[model samples]
Target: MLLEDHQLQSIQWTELSRGISFGVDGGCLVEAVERLGLVDIVTVSIVPGGQIVLEAPLGNAAAYWHPCFDPGDSLPADWAGRERFSAVRSAPIGVLVDANGQSSFAFSFDCLTQEGEIEFGASEEAKTFVVRLAITDGLAAARSTVRLAVVAPELAHEQAVRELSVLLHDGIAGRQASEIAREPVYSSWYAYSQQISHDVIMRNASVASGIGCKSVFLDDGWQKFGDGRWYAGCGDWVPDTAKFPDLRGTVAELNAAGLQAVMWIAPFLIGEQSAAYSGLARYATHYSEHLRTWVLDPRHREVREHLVAVCTRLMRDYALDGLKIDFLNDVMNYAGTPSTGDVPDVGDAMTLVLSEIAQALESVRPGSLIEFRQPYISPAVAPFADVIRANDCPADADQNRRSTLNLRLLAISQVVHSDPIMWDPSAPVEAVSRQLLNVFFSVPQISMPLDVLPEAHRARAAELLTQWRALRDVLLGGELSVGLPNEGYPVVSSRLGSTLVVAAYQPRLLDLDLEGVSELVILNSTASSALPYTVFGDVPPVGSALAEGETAARVVEFAERGFVEVPAWGITRITLGA
Candidate 1:
């Protein structure tokens, strides 16, 4: 739609489906445009080519937005230095915005379960931005589609991103994620990694249950002993009897402890040391030199069948309520064996595999949760995954904050989760509080061994979890508005009904229209003790509570007070007079 004014000499364009199409060597690039108000949603379906380049007038574009795991500001004009790449489990959408956060251009591809590269380079002579979208693994044998949205200059970047999400969601027919997907979890990955025992898990599960976590996100090292081999023992989904002698009993124990059991499985990674690798190596397209594992090509019926059976047996035999499927994006690294599999395209193969697995797991137990991590949270994978999580940032709270907020925006109706929050057992209470506050919007995943943590630290975790549980609706179900993303989102606020909850990662002004809120909660995640604000209406504060339960600093004269100070790294709940 943005190419309406551009003229090309070599290529001839034709009208198709109220849009445009052009020919490539092997096939045609078809763009179907659906206009929603002033926004043009252009779906570009292409048969693999070297790349597809579209030139658009580069007007007033100052900054760019990508679903990045880290925080940073990038200018589209500076694209000559570096190109951005995204996969199923990484940043999958891109947008160029002006200084006021208004989107100039936005685009996202469907079926990016594999890696796709989007390059934004300026055409100095034409005074336009040359947008290039390509499959990094080279031209595919079948058509893959990328949707581009030309948003009005008045629409904010967040709104533009959500528009793309809506287009992708409907085009792919993604489902409304179940409520169970949003429940808080306690994961064993960061705490124990590959080294975990049944006894250790049970101890943690009891403590986790007491701390308001609804599920035990059992991570890797369950299928094999903690030999520190690092995924070398993957591909086999069976639990190591020594570590989990009674795997079924372990699930039952977790259920009895009021925690759902979710196991971790990597179906694509078959370690050289694994028995499955010996039998299934023929189905693999490439051996990952970095992982030292054979990446199975799921296009093959044998590979998909093998993985589905393994996942089904694991869920049925162990009575697992859910699974944390990992390393799926590996399928994008290489094409499947030529002329050997039922599904040809890597994207199609993955979709089929995930669909079959989800169906099979559901047959075993109703409402079975399927969790996929970042980059993989695209529309194509949305129908299958119940929860989409931030990538592994471990102890980085700010990174988790950025990652989760980005996820929340792109994953519209689906459940988004943070990487399991892990902190030092001796970390200061405020430091621990910051970790919890950072991922306040998404479902919390705590990876600390709660039973082993210091009493004060454990109490803090419990307190925060309690607080989050009480405000889960306002946090997740409410209207989300985030501050400048280029600033790593210094402020994030959600409003539901009459309640407003704002988390300040950096102390700043709260210059907001406070018309609808009867209760305002400000969470101070920064080291600063106070956040400044200006009141707009006639309402005055009637009651106040500090997050740490510290004595009040001072009673503010609302008519003249400019700022309110609370305990550092704590919250202030101001009850407003009606």
Candidate 2:
């Protein structure tokens, strides 16, 4: 394997089957080769410092891939080829940590065109940390290059992330920026699903505006014949007069109500019943049995132009504020289909289409928001999107948090958003608050029907959303700290200058150094009625505090020396004295 430190010894390959070979090329590139009809595994061992921090492409899926632990022990042989919605879960980057929680070494894939995975596990027999690079599909027969670096242990995590970002940016082509990247949005997917109408949308937009949501996204059911069939009206890109007699008027009404209008569109998918489906048969990548639709081949210039034109017209015709592009990952090249254009790979083609769409839309509506989700969330496509949201996890709060953090760590300057929060409205206020707390670090998109919510739920939601808006700047742009994967991120906090915001997902003792912190707001996500915390540093005992939600007034002060308890599932703002 390639080593950053020349003094380091060569990698010892414990198991190298006959069909595969490893070598160093140009004194820098580490090349691994596998012949036809052979499944090979390459293993390397190293002794890292104190705690090892493994960075996975996606969120924590302990059963499949763990950052510091070996998921191979329980992983099935077919795990490498297992069908999944995202490829980040199997991304080829692994960061090694030193004793003091600093980065010691890191391994990354320089080639973005191929699909691969780097799995780590402790080798008890070898007494050294083992990493297995599992390359398959496109790279199985061809050569694959993996880059290794020995980072200085003194490098801070943020610095390391910045460095990594630069490296990735150099390798990729675009960066994303938008004014609405961090703004709160209201989505109709979870709330209305396929059952949507002009009245429902206008009603939701009015309510969303009252709660400080800046944008209203009409998702999935606006196009003609877009009812039960998800993409039946996809390629046409025309409004369904049945659902809304005047689509333009609906958008105008939303704008009148003080909400930016955003719509969801899938550019690379064509329903079988669509008029263009039969005519564009040559542009089909493959007929997806799962989606029951034809995935458009993005490599074709004609197809890319069509997508760009459709998006530009939406902005020019309806005066939309943004477009949420869904199912972008479907445009990737499949094994059996040969590309129809000069593009070398489908990824490059996908990026090209995205760039064109972004440019065209922005030209019509400057600063228009373009949003994408996981799988297609690589640095290469960042330039084409203003907001990158976590893949849909529905009511699972932990997964939503983990996904949001994963995107935030990689997307860097881009707005990272949580999956639309859709929970049972009848649930306890505390439980509902837990869902909100999980995604507190990123932009929150609410997708529930607030009009039908209970009075108590409505009040609680309003209070939390108001508080969220008050702290939006710091929470979105501040220095962030997250609990390790092992702990399931029970605590996540962000600090901007002297102001700190902390969200506790579990009942754990939290210690904060309030040296420069003037205002500390703690949000408890636990089920308990109160949250116990400790504060130290240059701050004195709390003088006065305001508790909103279920928090009782008496529990605001530090009940036990240095320990302060606040109401659970609510926000508590604590003022510190010098």
Candidate 3:
């Protein structure tokens, strides 16, 4: 309903300089042509009907771009080249909104030919607002297209995202939902990092099972040591017999303890010392001087086969339930020549390789869990993986919340996971609960050594986790509503059937409409001692509050449009009247 008001028109092309031309066809498709070198900026001016705002998901765990620019402001500046810009940090999908926070126009590119930036600013020369799509990394004699859409003003953000998701799913490989994607998983990166060993992993898995985690992701440190660098031991996909004397037994033990075993692997990276590095040198598309590793060229048939074989072996030999494919964004050649001899674009290559790996693993083990992180998170790659996790943002709950919400808005039906949550074990129970509560809507992957956590903290985690498990279905599958941007989602609400759940990050009073909603749960994610809330429909005046560190919910008073003094980082559940 929101996309019918605007019409695509006024198609025109302009030659900005030698060997370069830019134009729009049928009002929605923006095309750029380069004959010899890179074309940086192509500007298009339009008279926006309302307040102008742009929404772009960042490349990684950084902030989402939702800046509301005035008549004179410039778009946010770029961060140099792709190497410095972080991998695949910006998606082609963006929304243009009017003053009423309604979608006016939306845009998405089919593929990323090269690393680029699409920015918007007020153009004094044209006396109108202009959108500029810049290719920071020069493309050699190529053409690119950016698809656009005109939507109705009343279309909500979530609805617009749903439409975008459909477009992406149709364009790329679309993923089917899986149960393991929604289950709670434990990761070893935050707890052990490179210090992981067989015994430590089992101990962590044992505790994870005790606290209701269904899977354990054993992160870096399985292969032979290589110069003390975490990824230096990569590319070999072999279990270091020294640390893991009996890999099969370890997996069996974990499965026996009710925990599925997931291993982390970087398919693109080839350590210098790894034997595979010398044998696969011809397949190297990019070399990272920082990590001193070569990024395997996925476009090469042999390279794809190698990656597939690696994943296949992990699933077949070790009998792993899943694989956390890491560093997928590093497959591109940022420093050297962009493309050579009909090589596919980095984005396309990544999609193909990941698809093959996922297919190979699933063939051996049906419904095998596959995890991928940010930057590689696009509709094209979504179909190849079951779980898309927020990138690493250790101890930063706010970033994790933002990343999860951003991913949810884009992934739609897929399981959007939080960055493995790692916080100071010494923090108060209330503080620790805030970490879990921040990502309440998405599947959570805890990466802390539970056995070593303070008893109070462990108990708090168990209480919050239990409540989360009970509400997992509603929280993960419900219709989601994200409040105004830039305010860090002061209020995020999800609704399913007659149940309504709301989480408040800011201290502002939350005004909720509960028509036909029989049950309501509110989570206070702030540091304040209490959360203030009000319901619009006919509901009970009192509810039950579950304070942090407490196992029981105590009866609490809730007057219509009045504040309920919930504990800091706690929750309250209210029942409604018929």
Candidate 4:
């Protein structure tokens, strides 16, 4: 309902719901574009420096590619200096490109004119600008690349317009059913190993409400496990008496604890001993036989109906809030043959299954949050999901670090972003806290296990979530600013009005001209102390080409200074009035 039209000095923009038109002031560009339907578009200016190139993403031919770093491939000498900013996360945030190829950032959504405040004018007071993009429905995509495009609103909607109109016809090629508008994210039960206990679930949920977190998910090990089967004989959703002791009692307690109970369910993968499999079951697809554990025969109307019925009973009988639909790895490269000669669109099959499951859940509880973990099919899954998990967390710090790179890279290349609520690994308290803080640079929840944490972690989790909930609105809704990252550590800062949130990892120096910024929040991930908080009007006088327009101020560091050294791995907040 809100529309923003920036007045570019070089062009005048006109907009209508049907399409857009543009006119030029002193050039032929507008004249050519106006005839071609380019108007009110997100604009990108290619500053000639930093040898960054833009390529078209695989499926989307309209957008351009960007700068990249390949740890796997040997590159030309000094590759870092010769590149463009291929920062997809920063796409929503303003990015700074330096002459020597390094990039810093400052996100200023506000525009202004000569007067103090300009209404919808090119002034610093008005704030609202975003890249326009359209998501097409029923894509015939194999893989996708992250390509950034400077788009106008009209252009963004135009490209995605087809998706809105396309209707899914049952078993008719790729399209399956009508779409809905709610965005979704999925839930997971701490990777594949669910070792969760009833008491642990209740303890976690009790605190989840205090931190304003929702979705009390009782992950793993609840189903009765039988002999000679790892995950078999557990397809039926019966609580393990050994684990739950009083299963119904536990569900009742969770409801009273102010948490929406969400249980994890893997649709397929029946163990050989499972009652459903022990009796007699036909392969859903001939390919299901090849899968490790038994794959559910979703193609069978009975199987689909039974799956829906069980899920519905959890709500109707148990009063559970939602379900964490897990283990979709089956579709990862699955090329199964249906019974007939007609092959189903692999993408369509995935979509249909998702649609059916989503419909079943909604019919039971109109507002239930259906979460899934499909980082691979993120772009496709994003529109339909309520929550999306980035991926299962690896067990150690090194793997945890790799997850960051993979997750960030995935966010860009796939052109989709998701938050992983898995607990921060048993890392150094500071490391864990700062890691969570940085993840908050984008909108993600801090879903960590606080019950078993040692003293420091418990304190950090409580303090971090407390502060996060108090400022989540600002973090989720404010303008973003990111700085150049160093090896092993990174820094990103954001501001919403007078409140400033800055999170820094490892020990380092951050000197940037936060033009209108009046605050600072620092989260030091390193065990050592950092210097001081004095401001300097320029980039550090290091061995470099600090450009002419790059005005900056340094917050002086006091080595061995007592008060200003940020806590090892603690989030700190500061306020500045501009």
Give the alpha-carbon lDDT of every model: 0.73, 0.64, 0.65, 0.41
Cα lDDT tens digits, model 3, 163-202, are 6656646655556655577888888888888778789988
Q: Could you say which candidate leads in TM-score? A: 1
As a TM-score, model 4 comes out at 0.59
Scored by lDDT, model 1 comes in at: 0.73
**For candidate 2, lDDT tens digit of each residue in 1-578?**
21222212343322233111232222333233332221222222211111111222211122222222222232222223232212222234444343333433343444344444443443333323334443443443223333433222334333454455555556454544666667788899999897788988987777788776888889998887788855655688788888989888999999899888889998788877778777677788577766677888877888888888889999899999889988876665353255567664565676678889888988899988888877566665667887888888899898888778766656655788889998898787765687777888889988899778777766666677788889987888888776553445677888998899888888877767667777888888876655556666443455457778434343244433344667767787877652
* Candidate number of the best lDDT: 1
Q: Write the per-residue lDDT of candidate 4 for residues 1-578, one digit (tens) a residue.
A: 01222223324444322322222222212211122132122222221111111111111111111112222221211112122110001112122222222221111111000001101101122221212211111111221211221222322221222111121111223222112111111223442245666766766665555554554566666777722224556567777777778766787887776555677777655656567775324643323334446665444455556677777777666676666676664533333333221223344444556667777777787766665553322333434445444455433332233333333332321221234445445666655454456555433444456555466665655566666656664554554443332132244445687555655554545544444555555655556555333344443212111111124433433222224544455554443331
lDDT for model 2 comes to 0.64
- Residue-level lDDT for 331 in candidate 2: 62
Q: State the local distance difference test value for candidate 4.
A: 0.41
lDDT of 2 at 71: 21
TM-score-best of 1 and 3: 1
Runs in model 1 deviating more than 4 A are 1-34, 43-62, 76-92, 109-115, 121-129, 134-141, 144-147, 171-179, 336-339, 535-561
TM-score of each prediction: 0.88, 0.81, 0.81, 0.59
For model 1, residues 1-578, the per-residue Cα lDDT tens digits are 21222233344543322122322222445557676764565665556544455554567766667766343545634245234332354544667666666766666555455446665545556566555555444335454565555554456777878877776677565554654677889999899888888998998988898878899988888886335756666777777889999989989999998989998888899877777778898888587777777888887899989989998998888988888898887777755335477765677777888899988988887888889987677676777887899998989998999989998888866788999999988767776898999999999999987777888887888889888888899999888887666677788889999899988888887754567666778888887877787766666454455455756533343442376766677777766653
Error of 3 at 351 (Å): 2.0
